[model samples]
Target: MSKIADNIESTPHSDLAKGDEHSVKTGRILVAIATYNEIENLPILVERLVDTLPEADLLVIDDGSPDGTGQWCEEHAKMNVRMHCLHRKGKPGLGSAIIAAMQYAIDNNYDVMVNLDADLSHPPEKIPELLEAWRLADSDSTVAIGSRYIHGGGISGWPLKRHFMSRAINMYTRWLLWLPMADCSGSFRAYPVNLLRKIDFDSFLSYGYSFFEEVLYHLKEQGASFVEVPFQFVERQYGSSKINMRKAIVAVWTIFRLGLKAWNPF
Candidate 1:
C-alpha cells in the first residue's frame, strides 16, 4: 500500500472503500467536478462517471448553486458510499473550487485527483485513459491532460469565434509561460496529490478560467511533468455558458501578468 493509503487506514475515513482493492493499477483516485448551477448536467455526469470508474471516489465541489445542485449532491452522497460533496458560499469561480478539491485530495490522502468540467463537455469514459497516461508517465510529479488539440482529438461543437479565442490563449500560454502542452485551457486533467501539495493554493491570482493556465505554470515551476492524452471534446447541450466577456478579458490580462514573472516575457 502507498503511504497515503497507509495514513488513511489509520484515520476515521479508513472504512471508506479503497479503489486499489478493485483496480490495482489505479491507486486511490478522487474524481473532482466543480459545479455552479450544474443541476441539468451534473446528475447524468455523476451517473456516467460512477459507472465508468466505480473504483474511484467522486467529489462534487459546488459553489452554492441555487438550482439545488448542492442538495442533489448531498442526497446522492448519502446513498453512494464513494460519492462526496463540498459546498461553498456563492459563485466564487472555478479556480477556487478546484483549489478546494486539491486541498481535499491532500487531506484525504488520495493518490490522484482527476478534475473535469461538470458540464459533461469532457467525457467520463476518457478518465481511464488519463489514469493510464499518468501511470505510464516518466516522472512521479506528472499531470495528464485530456487534450482536444492533440492527434485523434477534436471538438464536436464550438463556434469559429470560440475556436479562435481558445487557440489564441493557448498560443499565448505556450509562448509566454513556455508550456508545451497543446491544450492549456482545457479542464480535464489528472494531478497527483503529492505534487499538488507542494504548491500553495492560497496564493492563486486567477480565480476564473485563467486558473487553468496559471496552475500549469506553477506546477512546471515545481518540476512537474505534463502529458497530453488525446480526447474528443463535446460542447454542453444544456444550460447557458457561465463564461462572459469579462472573464475572457481577465484571462488575457492574468496570463500577461504571469508571463512577466517568466524569464522570456514576450
Candidate 2:
C-alpha cells in the first residue's frame, strides 16, 4: 500500500481544489477498476472513460498482472493526468482490488467512487447517469447499482445456460438475503465515498464474485439505501473471464456463511 500512497503523492493535485468548490461536486467521480492480465483491454477502457467523463479520475488496481499491465499503466501515467494505477504483489481477488481502490478514494477525499470493468462491458457513457441518480436520491442513497435484472436491463451475448445460471444465482441470493437491489452480482456501480467508509471493509469475507453479493447484503443489513439503474450488459470483447467452477462453488459456500453472519451479527 505504500507504493499506492507514493503514487498518489506523486500525482499533481494543484487543480483538485480549484474553481471555488471546497467540497467536490457529484461529477467529481472516481472510477476504480480492478484488473488482472487485462493489458489488451485497459488502454481502450481508459480512453473511453476519459472521453465519456472527462472530469472523473481513474484508479486501476492491477494484481501484478504478468502480462505487463503494470508497466503499461506506468507508461500511460506519464501522459495521462487523470489516470493512476496500483500494482499489487500477486493475483488477489476482485474484492481486495475493490477494497484497495475504495481505500485510495476515501483517503483522497473523493465525492463518489465507482467500480467498473476493464473489458469495456460496462459502458462509460452510463457513468454520468449513475451519478445523476445518486445525486437525485440525495445523500441517503448509499449505492447506485447498474442492474441487468430490472426492466429495460438485460444481458447480451450470453448463452441460454449462462443467462439462466446468472438469474438463478441472483434469485437465490435475493431469497436468502432479502436484498432490495436486483442485480447483486453486477459489479458496475457507484457509491458515496463517505458512506463506503462506514461499512467495515475489513469484516467483508468473500474475495471473489460472491463479494458483490455479500457487500450488498451487509449494506442492506446496515440500513444503507440504494437505487438500481438499468444497464445493457455486454459480453467481454477481449480476454477470457476469470470465473470458474471452483469460484462458483466458493460463491455458494460464501453465501451460506455470510448470509448467516448478516442475519446474526452478534
Separate clash counts for every candidate = 0, 0
* lDDT measured at residue 25 in model 1 versus the true structure, 0 to 100: 58
lDDT score for candidate 1 against the true structure: 0.85
- Give the winner by lDDT: 1
Q: Residue 151 in candidate 1 has what lDDT?
A: 96
Q: Model 2: which ten-residue window has the lowest total lDDT? A: 1-10
lDDT of 2: 0.79
Residue pairs with backbone overlap in model 2: none
Candidate 1 C-alpha error for residue 146, in Å: 0.4
Q: Model 2: residues >4 Å from true position, as ranges?
A: 1-27
Tens-digit lDDT string for candidate 1 (162-189): 9999999899899999997999999999
